[model samples]
Target: MTASLSQLSGRVWIYPGDPDPEAVMPCVAVVADDAGSTVVDAGQSPAHARLVQSALAEAGLPAARRLVYTHHHWDHTWGACAWEVEEIVGQESGATLLSAEARRSWSQEYLQEQVVANPRLGPSFKARARAMTGWADFAVRAPSRTFTDRLMLSGGIEVRHVGGKHAPDSTVVAVPGSGVLLLGDCFYPPPFHLREPGPAGEEIDLRQISALVAEGFDWYVDSHSPPWRPPVPE
Candidate 1:
């Protein structure tokens, strides 16, 4: 499933976003146009990034030249190290946060300490982290480009920093020609829970979903769930 690629609309292809029940990682999207190929988000680990790369190769598209992040969360930003993308982009705040996280060295000793220090984590969770040595040492490649508001790419992809239901640095990636909108963990099923545990994240405004119909997206994608069709307004 991780190696599959499905067409969303026109030249935009999607790597359906689904993660383990308790996991928050990249369910990525690819926009392949004449300008080149761009991966919307890098996944959670080098392994996750490999899956994306494999999918792209299978599709016969150019190597993903540009990668953009939806937010600063490790799940979406950590995988950039695995790709030889020429440009990495994100909102300024998210870029800064991700840079700090990338800069933090994660040693076996460090992971063990992090688990022990956190009162919220259980033994199994710590054990899981300890077992996954691949996640310990990797590049936390920060965005080469940062935008405060909205930025349009030369390839006709529009990235808008619409602060709503999720991280403060959250932005919407729109492939206008395809009428495809990628919602990065902004609004998901149940639509009531945070992308992460605890109260740190913001809740998406349910009322605004109806407005998405007005915006006219042929398809909608989520970070932790499958892509869905917007409800048709009567």
Candidate 2:
């Protein structure tokens, strides 16, 4: 099994997995520009966060003072507790979700139960949780900076609160300089399953996704899948 898969390019860095092979870990991104580096999203656990941090150091990118979130899912935000970042940015709705009580956001107990319930996730959970020191003192942090529409990062990357596809708080990180778009939890057929729909909750609308795909990108990175050219949205 692949322990971890990392890829680096002139524009972006992708650290796609955790130490464990079986866990459903989100792929984290780092976009580099003139000022410094911007972390696109946190990962599954503290260990994954460290892996991301190490990847940045290895790539010789500047220290990441800004950590951006694609959405407020457990796998994406849990690692926020691990990254020692100065500012966290996300959609206002995603920030609201994180501002909630840790349990309300995502309970460690609930996550443990989930790991135990799914045989596929068992090995990864054990490894990640152990690395996180028994998941002790699990915490969630609210984003220091929140945006309803679009926000620009150090590297000229734009993070937009483009929801209605997976979670209402879903976000898309697009780096025009690098020709990459990090679509968080973008379901293939456009899952349109939203949690707590509001201003950010818009329908996936396959046509729009197809349009974005057609716009062209050097790389499309997502949470669970390998980095590849995005197919015309079906």
Candidate 1 lDDT tens digits, 16-56: 65555545444799999656698998886677778888988
Clashes of 2: 0
Root-mean-square deviation of every model? 3.8, 5.9
How does each model score on lDDT?
A: 0.74, 0.70
Model 2: pairs clashing at backbone N, Cα or C within 3 Å? none
Name the TM-score of candidate 1. Answer: 0.84
Top model number, TM-score? 1
lDDT of 2 at 29: 84
Worst 10 residues of 2 by lDDT: 187-196
Please identify model 2 stretches exceeding 4 Å from their true place.
1-8, 18-22, 101-132, 188-205, 230-234
* Estimated TM-score for each candidate: 0.84, 0.75
Quote the lDDT for 198 in model 2: 67
- Strongest candidate by lDDT: 1
Error of 1 at 156 (Å): 0.8
**Per-candidate clashes, comma-separated:** 0, 0
Q: Which lDDT tens digits does candidate 2 get at residues 31-113?
A: 76556667877776666777778767776777777788888876787788888778889899888777773655234465488
